[model samples]
Target: MTDTSCIEIPEESSSEKVQQIDLLYKCISKLKEADRVLITLVLDEKPYEQIAEITGITENNLRVKIHRIKKELTEIFHKYARL
Candidate 1:
């Protein structure tokens, strides 16, 4: 979603990694439960079809939703990055 293939998880200092993890949790916590679950499954590398079946959504619709969710995550992550 949102071409996340371009995003590289940088090797960071331990403290920086912890801060990034904290920021990620904060961002994810703001999502609705369904969105949270979807994102989590995506993060876990679950297949789209499987995720769709579990969430009772069509694959196309789930793709769109995941794109939007990733966009939101990018925005939230940037907010924390700025700080």
Candidate 2:
């Protein structure tokens, strides 16, 4: 028998997802170029070491930056989400 336990399901409808994506992109666009690149790399699932090498930063710094970027992105996303 096939294992279905690992399968994931989405709670949002297609249109809601599209709208959320649109809002996310809008928020991302407002970020600085470096922040945009960093966030994109994270979203792409690049390893921390690789991301640090590419960004020329230490792993600890990268983690801190990622945390801050996410916080900023959340704020931006919420600001746009209300509109």
Candidate 3:
């Protein structure tokens, strides 16, 4: 989650599922190994401690990484929304 380009994808359904999936594919492709795990844990709304446990990263490190990921997602959304 350190890319600052990942968007806050919705949980609700829409006719644009395919399009959203495409976007997800593109964004996920750019993530690093650690970022991918962090992103999934976050999408599942897993708690901080859980994320740390699952990732084997310290909670403080996880928090910083999550912040970076959120920033990356924001940038990605801004760039891809027009696509």
Candidate 4:
């Protein structure tokens, strides 16, 4: 899986943060409901084990799903950022 841990979102003021969140929700809205939930939990920084338990999947499988989800989100985010 690709390493995404090094990526950092810069901290911004409250107004900027709201705009960023709006963009995020717009991006996530394109995903399936399950994938939207997965991305939301991930952005919340929930641990892998907890996410696995909540999703009723094994940690390994959860990791794979998260990896794919992150990659998709990254693409969407970048696409939007360019606009």
Candidate 5:
């Protein structure tokens, strides 16, 4: 977090707000579906075994994917911050 920056969203109606949220989902839709799945499970604080069972993936693979997703998110933020 930095005091030198801030986020400002233009005032929008409720419907517009939903549209804005959908727009973000749409961007992720273009990304690998696996990453989306990883995000969903990780956000819920699910254990690796649970995520694996839900996704039918091996636990080790799930760990690798989660790590990759963290890196991906970091890059996504960096990409936006530079803009």
Candidate 6:
């Protein structure tokens, strides 16, 4: 016998989600075109191998680039969020 239970997931209000998404897009827009493309692919949940192939960069370089891009995006997001 197995007991089944439903776990409740907290949901953000649609308006709040929309605002956050708008802020994220604004942050992404501030990035260079190449960075924007790479981040977009990453956000789309593309695998690292496919991203590397698509961007013509090695996996190691891709990882480093992603780290930098995320750091930059976070800064940008925080800057705008503070306003």
Q: How far in Å is the alpha carbon of 69 misplaced in model 3? A: 0.6
Model 6, residue 48: what's the lDDT? 95
lDDT of each: 0.93, 0.93, 0.83, 0.91, 0.75, 0.98
lDDT of 6: 0.98
Quote each prediction's TM-score: 0.79, 0.84, 0.68, 0.74, 0.61, 0.86
For residue 50, give model 6's deviation from the true position in Å.
0.4
Ranking by lDDT: 6, 2, 1, 4, 3, 5
Candidate 4 has its poorest 10 consecutive residues by lDDT at 8-17
For candidate 2, list the clashing residue pairs, or say none.
Answer: none
Model 6 is weakest, by summed lDDT over 10 consecutive residues, at 1-10
Candidate 4 clash total?
0
lDDT of 4 by residue, 1-83 (tens): 98999999887889998988899899999888999998889989999899999999999999899899989988999999899
How does candidate 2 fare on TM-score? 0.84
The segments of candidate 2 whose C-alpha lies over 4 angstroms from its true place after superposition are: 1-10
**lDDT score for residue 54 of model 4:** 96
Q: How many times do residue backbones clash in model 1?
A: 0
Off by over 4 Å in 5: 1-30
TM-score of 4: 0.74
Clash pairs, candidate 6, are none
Using TM-score as the measure, the top candidate is 6
Per-residue alpha-carbon lDDT of model 6 for 1-83, expressed as tens digits?
55546756789999999999999999999999999999999999999999999999999999999999999999999999999
Residue 47 of candidate 3: its Cα lDDT?
98
